[model samples]
Target: MTNLLRSIRTLPLLAFLIAIPALAAPTIIELSSEASRPAINDLVRATVSAEATGTTLGELSKQVNSLIAEALKTAKAFPRVKTQSGNTSTYPIYSKGGKIESWRIRSELSLESGDTAALSELLGKLQSSLGVSNLVLQPSPETRKKAENEAMLDAIAAFKARAKVIADAFGKPYRIKQLSVNTSGNVVQPLFRATAKAMMADAAPMPMEAGESQISATVSGQIELE
Candidate 1:
């Protein structure tokens, strides 16, 4: 009777050990699929700065600060545009003799808006007092998220289709052993550099062209053919 009981206990252990090798899938394959689409740019951004050089640091600081403050006040006239202070730096201007000749101070104001036309008009007005340093056009967060979700769905479908094709080619059934999905987009546009001196001189409503970005999603995984 003791031997019979020992045999019963060993039966379960043996079965578990036997199942381990079957769980280690031998025919595993890795595959990846990607989907991308053009997303329309809906946001416009501009960076404007005021710079002054004088013998006194305090005087340069006052001038640069005053110009940035005036630009912020003008930005308020356009309710749709958003304004924020960027960078402020004070540095010494060196003379040809390697002596500090004067002090220079510069401050930047960042502007963003969904209404491109209004923002463009504001930029022109601000350029009269401040120099236009940079301009950018890109999709807003909401728009980019929507595009990413759409691309993810397409990419996942493509991955599954490819897995099915591979399984069929091998004349075997398959199951996903591991899977991962990632998303990315061309969010960084090429830096637009404008001649600040010339822009300040003209101060016309800045011309802009809204471009598109390629938002993409990739699905990668390993599948086991049974």
Candidate 2:
């Protein structure tokens, strides 16, 4: 009987132990760090487009193709320039009465170069047949990569410094629970735009300016205090 009574007493203790909840997780603080640097725009890009309209799709296609081919050949003569064909489309032109009057075909050629002088001269030459659709000045791939690497280093250092500051102020040691790094590339708009007729009228080389681009890097994560 005494043993049975002892067993009954132990049952309540086991129940109490099971009812207790697990320990709470430690607190975490998030920190964000960023770094940015200016990079010179070293690359120039120009887009030229050719369009033709005719009663027949075949004629329009032939004309547009010839123009693009000539442009491509001219671009190839300049060794420093890189050339590629862009978007091509064929659509029907409707008259005021809602009837199809002609077929319109359009093609684009893209040119990129680090040599501003050569590219500008080539653009001037092609203006007779092709119109400038868009122009942009930006950092080259190599330059952007270099800037991103430098920014990443700066961001990581900043993150570590901030974590140390927080830990010291709180009188505790910190460990990095998670970390992520991200990089951003800059976009630059063209400074000038010219029509085909205007470009053809002027025999002088096209003038251009390469501005500056900003590269940025960010580091964010949670730091656990111990």
Error of 1 at 191 (Å): 5.7
> In model 2, which runs have C-alpha deviations exceeding 4 angstroms?
1-25, 191-199
Model 1: C-alpha RMSD to truth?
A: 4.6
List, residue by residue over 177-196, the lDDT tens digit for candidate 1. Answer: 99999999875444566534
> Per-residue lDDT for 1-226 in model 2, tens only?
9999999999999887776643435658999999988888889999989988789888888888998998888888899999988999888889999999888788988999999889989988898878888988889999999999999999999999999999999998989999999999776877666544454765456777788899999999999987
TM-score of each: 0.85, 0.83
Which ten contiguous residues of candidate 1 have the minimum total lDDT?
A: 187-196
Q: What is the lDDT of residue 76 in candidate 1?
A: 92
After superposition, which runs of candidate 1 have C-alpha atoms over 4 Å from their true positions? 1-25, 188-191, 200-202
All models: lDDT? 0.87, 0.87
Candidate 1 TM-score over all chains jointly: 0.85
